[model samples]
Target chain A: MIRIEDVSLRHGQTQILHDIWLTIPKGGITALVGPNGAGKSSLLSLIARLQPLQAGRISVDSFPVDTTPSRDLARILAILRQDSIVTSRLRVRELVGFGRFPHGRGRLTPDDYAIIDQSLQQFDLTDLSDRFIETLSGGQRQRALVAMAFAQGTDYLLLDEPLNNLDMFFARELMRSLRRIADENGKTIVIVLHDINQASAHADRIVAMKSGRIVADGTPSDLLTPKTLQAVFGFQMRVETFDDMPVVLHFR
Target chain B: MSIAATKQASKTGWVAGLTLAVLFVFSLCVGVDDMPIIRLFSDGRALELLLVSRLPRTLAAILTGAGLAIAGLIMQTLARNRYVEPSTAGTAQSAELGILLVTLLLPSASLLFKSLAASAAALLGTSLFLMTAHRLPPTQPFLVPLFGLVYGGVIGAAVTFVAWQADLLQYLSVWTNGDFSGVLRGRYELLWLGALMVVVAWMVADRLTIMALGRDASIGLGLDHARMLQLGLIIVSVISALSVVVVGMIPFVGLVVPNIVSRLMGDNMRGTLPTVAVSGAILVLGCDILGRLIRYPYEIPVGTVMGCVGGLIFLWLLFRRPSHV
Candidate 1:
C-alpha cells in the first residue's frame, strides 16, 4: 500500500499539486484520470519520488519514501515515466536486464537472468529481445519500457501515461497485460491514464483529479458518471453501459 | 550477450591489442634520432634514447588519447549530448586557467600540486556546465553543445586575456597547442595519473552505462544518480586536467574516438570501454606518426593534426544524419 499525506508541490510561482492526500491500497489496479494540468502526472512523480516532495509524507508498505534508501525502496516500488528517455543504444534484453540492477548491482546471477527472461516473455518481447530500442516503433518501445519496470519485480508499479504514443490495439494490449499482472501476481498498479473508457473497462478503481486536488475516488461504476465527469472535466460527458461496464464517451 | 557477439568482441579486442602493440613498436622506432632498430638491443646509447625520448613520448600520446576519449565519453553520457567533449565543455579551459593562476601565485609549486589545482578547477567548470545544462529546455538537444562551445570560448578568452596581461602569452600558447615533442622521461610522468583514471573508469563502467538511461531510469534502477554523476564528473575532471597539463589540449581525440566506438559497438560501457580506450590510443599514435612524417624534423603538433582530422569528422557527423540531438 502507498500512502500520501498533505502533499503540495510548487513549481516556480505555480502550484502543481495542492494538498494531495490519497491512499492506494495493495494488490489492485487503480487508474488516475484527469484533464490536462490536473496534476495527475505530478502526483505520480511525487509518489515515485522522481520529484522531491516539498510538503508531504509518503510511505509505501510502511517504509517512508523520503527516508528509505533508494535501493531499499526500489525493491518495493518501480516507476516508468512517460518521458523516460534512453539515449544509449541498448538492446531490448539489455534494457530489461537493467531492471535487476537493484538486486545484483551489475553482476547478474542465474536467478536474475531467469526473472529477466520471464519479464521479456511476459511482455511478448522475446522476438525483439536483441533489437536496439531506437529501432522499435513507439508502441513497441512503450511495451519494452513497461517490461523493464515489470522486470524489477517490485510489489508496486507506478506508470505515468504509459498509453502515450500507443495505438489503440497496443494501448488495450498493455492495459490487459497490466490487469493480468495485477490479478495473477497480486502486484499493485497505480497508472495515470488519459483515456477514461480504458480506465472504466480495465481498472478496478478510478481516482479523478481536478485543479491539483482529488475530486472523486471510487470504483469505475461510481466514478464514471455524466455528472462526475462534468465536475472533473468542466464539460458534460456521455456515459453508456456496455456489457455491464460504464464506458465514458467525452469526445463528442 | 549472445555467443556470436561475445566472440566478435573478443576478436575485436585481440585485433586492437595487436594493432596497438605494432603501433607502439613503430612509435618507439621512428624518431629524430638515428638509432638503428637492431642497435636498440646491443647498444646502450640507442637503448637509452629509446627509453628516455621515444618510449615516454609514445606512452604519453597513448595515455592522453585514452584519457581524453574516456573523459569525453563520460561527459557525453552525463550531458546526454554527443558533442559535449572536455574541450568543448570548458573543462580544458578551466585547467588552463588553473595553470595560469598557479604560475602566478605559487611560482614554485610542484608539478603534482599544479595538476591537482587544475583538476579542481576542471571539476568546478564541469559542475557549472552541468547546472546550466540541467535548466535548459530538452526539446532542442543541439543547444546543449552549442551552449558548451560558447561557454568554453568565454573561459578560453578570459584565460588568454589574463595570460596576456601577465606577460605569459608565450607560455599559454605552448600549452594550448598540444605537441608531444616536449615529452621525455621526466616530463611525461603526469600521464600515469590519466592511466589510473582509465582503470577506475573501467571498474565503474556498468554504473556509467546505467547513468545513460537518464535521471528517472537511473534512480528507478536504484542507482544513486547524483552520486554516480559526481563520480563520473570527478573522473572526467581528473582525466581532462591531467591530459591538458601533460600533453596540452588534444582536441577532438576525445570527441571523435568515443563517438566512432559507440557507433560500432553499443553503449554498454563494460563491453565497449576497452575498445574505446584502445581506439583512442591507436588514433593518437597514428596521428602523431603522421605529424612526424608530414614535416620531418619540423614536426607538426599532434593537436593541429587532430584538429584538422577531427574537425572534418565532426562536421560530417553533424550533417550525416538527422540525429535526435
Candidate 2:
C-alpha cells in the first residue's frame, strides 16, 4: 500500500498542493481525476518520490520515500511523467530496455529480454521496436514510453497523463491493457487522467480533487453524480449509465 | 532488421578501426625526414626518427582527435544540446586561463603540473557553466548553447586580457592554435591519460545515454543524476584540457564527429561511442595530415585547419537539428 499523509507543496508563495492524505492499496487501478491545476499530478509525483516531500510523509509498501535508497524504491515503483521528451535517437527496443537498468548492470539477460519483448507486445509496439524514437509518431512514441514503464516490472506504476498524445482508439486500447495488467499481474496503478469516461470505464476507484484537496473518493458511480461533479469540477455535467458504468457527458 | 543493423554497425566499427590502423602506420612515414617503410629495422637513424618524431606525432594526433570528440559528445549529452561542446561552454577557455596563471606564477613548473592545473580549472569552469545552465527555462533549449557561447566568450575575453596585461600573447597563441608539428616522444604522453578516460567513458556509455533522456527520466531509471553530471563534467574537462595542453585546441573533433556518427548510428552510446571515437581520430588525423601536406613542411596548425572545416560543419549542425529532428 502507498500511504501519503499531510503532504503539502509550495513553489514560492503559491501553494501547489494543500495538506492531503491518501492511501492507495496494492493490486488495482486507481484514477486521480481533477480539473486543470487540481494537483493531481503533484500528488502522484509525491507518491512516486519524483518530487521531494516538502511537508509530509509518504511510504510505498512500507518504504519511506525520502529515506529509502532510490535503487530500492525503483524496484518497487515506476513512474512515467507527462512531459518526457526523448531527444536521443534511441531505437524503441533500446529505449524500453532502459527499464531494466535498476535491476542489473545495464546488460540485458535473456529473462530481461523476454520481459522487454512482453512489454512491447503488450503495448502493440513490437512492430515498431527497431525504429528510432525520433521517427515515431506522437502516439507511437507515447506507447513506447508506456512500454518502457511496464517493463520496469514494479509493483506500483505511477503514470501522469499517459494518454496525452494517443487518440481515442489507442487510448481505449491502452486503458484496456492497463486493466488487463492490473487483473492478471496484480500490479497497483495510480494514473492521473483528464478523460473521466475512460477513468469510469476502466478505473476500479476514482479520487476527485479540486484546488489541491480531495473532494470525493469512491467507485465511479459514487463520484460521477451531478451533485459530486458540480462540487468537484465547479460545473454541471450529466452522468448516465453505459454498460452498467457511469459515463459523464461533460462536453455539452 | 534490428539484427541487420547490429551487423552493419559491427561492420562499420571493423572497417573504421582497420582504416585508422592503416592510416596510423602510413602517417608514421609522412614527415620531413623521409623514412621509408623498409629502412626502419635496418637503419638505426631511421628507427630513431620513427620513435622520436613520426610515431609520437601520429599517436598524439589520433589521441587528441579521439579525446576531443568524446569530450564533445559527453558535453553535448550533459548540456542536452548538440551545439554546446567544451569550447563553447568555457571549459577550453578556463583551461587556457589555468595554463596562463601557472606560467606566470611558476615559470619552472613541469609540463605535467601545467596540464593538471589546466584540467582542474577546466573542471571548475565547466561545472559552473552547467550549474547556471540548470536555471534557464528548459523550454528554450537553444538558449542553453547560446548561453554557453556567451559564457565561453566572456572567459575567453578574460583570458585574452590577462595574457595582454602580462605580455604573454605569444604563449597564448601557442596554446590556442593546435599543432602537432612540435610533438615528440616526451612532449605528448599526457594524452595517454586522455585515452584511458575514453575507456572510462565507454564503460559509462549507457548511463551517459540515459542522461540524454533528461533529468526526470534519468532519475526515474535509478541513476543519481547529480553524480553522473559531475562524472561527465570531469571527463569532458580532463580530456579537453589535456588536448589543450598537449596540442592546443583542435576545434571540431568533439563537436562534428559525434553529431555525424549519431546521425548514422543513433544515440545508444555504448554502441555508438567506439564509432564516434574512431571517427574523431579519423577526422583529426586526416586534418593533421592535410595540415602537414598543405604547406609542404612550412606547416599550418591542425587547430586552424579544424576551425575552418569544423566551423562549416557546425553551421550545418546548427541549422540541421530542428528540421532534422
Residue range with the least summed lDDT across 10 consecutive positions in model 2 chain A: A42-51
B1-325: candidate 2 lDDT, tens digit per residue:
2797799789989988998998898788787778987977999999999999998999999999889999999999998877778877899999999999999999899999999999999999999998888788877877888899899999999999999999999989888889999999999999999999999999999899989998888878888888999999889999989988888987877888999889888999999999999989988898888888897877888999999989898888777775753
Residues B1-325 of candidate 1 have per-residue lDDT tens digits of 6566668778888888899999999998887778898877899999899889999999999998888889999999989888789988899999999988998999999989999999999999999998999788888787898999999999999999999999999889766878899999999898998999999999988889989988988888788999989999999999988887878898998888888877767788899999999988998888898899897877999999999988998788768756545
Write down the TM-score of every candidate: 0.98, 0.98
Candidate 1 TM-score to native: 0.98
Candidate 2 deviant stretches above 4 angstroms: B318-322
Question: Per-candidate DockQ versus the true complex?
Answer: 0.77, 0.72
TM-score of model 2, chain A? 0.98
Error of 1 at B109 (Å): 0.8
- Residue B19 alpha-carbon offset, candidate 2, angstroms: 2.0
Candidate 1, superposed: residue stretches over 4 Å from native: none
Say which docking band candidate 2 falls in.
medium
